[model samples]
Target: EPEVTQTPSHQVTQMGQEVILRCVPISNHLYFYWYRQILGQKVEFLVSFYNNEISEKSEIFDDQFSVERPDGSNFTLKIRSTKLEDSAMYFCASSEETLDQPQHFGDGTRLSIL
Candidate 1:
């Protein structure tokens, strides 16, 4: 079965720097999402995108964060002015056709901020 894939499985960055995480969700999925899990914490929803527009976003997704589907197959999450608290395992996910479906997630991009 096809699965989501994230680039740079691990990333180390300085605090206040910018970071862009890349993901390629399942080809046939229609709903895409970005989530993060701080070490030893539960996964938290960040944002969701569908049909080229943002469907929903959580409080954690502030002006500093953005999501884009630059092309047919690539979806990305960009965090501007990264903070130490932003360090977490970022995950990309996709659902077949609706939010009700189970989302398949990538292995995750472990971000480390100093």
Candidate 2:
């Protein structure tokens, strides 16, 4: 089965540096989402995109963040400036239809901001 894949399973960066987290969503899915989980917190939705434009974004997706489908297969999230609070497991997910359907998640890119 096709599955979402994320790069650099773990990443450590200093505060204020830019970081680009990469993912390849399932080939046939139209809805993609980004979510984050702080150490022991519940998963929080960051943003969702479809048709090359943002469909929805949570308050957590502030000015420092942006996402793009750089190619037919790759999706990326860029953080203009990282903060300590940004440390979390950033998960990339995709579903065949909508949020009502179950989403498949990558192992995740663990961003560690220090």
Candidate 3:
């Protein structure tokens, strides 16, 4: 079975610094997405990518944040400048065939900004 994989199980960064979170789903997935869960808060959708472009994005994915699939294999989210409020658990997910299929998610990457 194909699954999603994420790098950096945990990260601690200073405010104003930059951090990149990475993910790799199976080769067949046509959709990719990023979500964040602030401690004690519900998970929120950040962005989604498809066909080499952004398919959807939430207000949280502002000018300071960006997502990319630099290679066909790795999906990445970059924070231009970290902020204390950015601390959260980031989840990467993918659906192989279509939205009807269940999304496969990676064990989240926890980001901590000081």
lDDT score at residue 36, model 2, on the 0-100 scale: 97
Better model by TM-score: candidate 1 vs candidate 2: 1
Per-residue lDDT tens digits of candidate 1, residues 1-114? 799999989999999999999999999999999999999999999999999999999999999999999999999999999999999999999998773689999999999999
Model 3: runs farther than 4 Å from truth? none
Of candidate 3, the 10-residue stretch with the lowest lDDT total is 95-104
Please list all clashing residue pairs in model 3, or write none if there are none: none
Best by lDDT: 1
Candidate 3, residue 90: Cα displacement in angstroms equals 0.2
Stretches of candidate 1 off by over 4 Å are none
Order of models, best TM-score first: 1, 2, 3
**Considering lDDT, where higher is better, how would the candidates rank from best to worst?**
1, 2, 3
lDDT of 3 by residue, 23-51 (tens): 99777888999999999999899998888
Error of 1 at 47 (Å): 0.5
**Clashes in model 1: which pairs?**
none
Q: In lDDT terms, how accurate is model 2?
A: 0.95
**Per-residue alpha-carbon lDDT of candidate 2 for residues 1-114, written as tens digits (9 for 90 to 100):** 789999989999999999999999999999999999999999999999999999999999999999999999999999999999999999999988884889999999999999
The parts of candidate 2 lying over 4 Å away from their true place are none
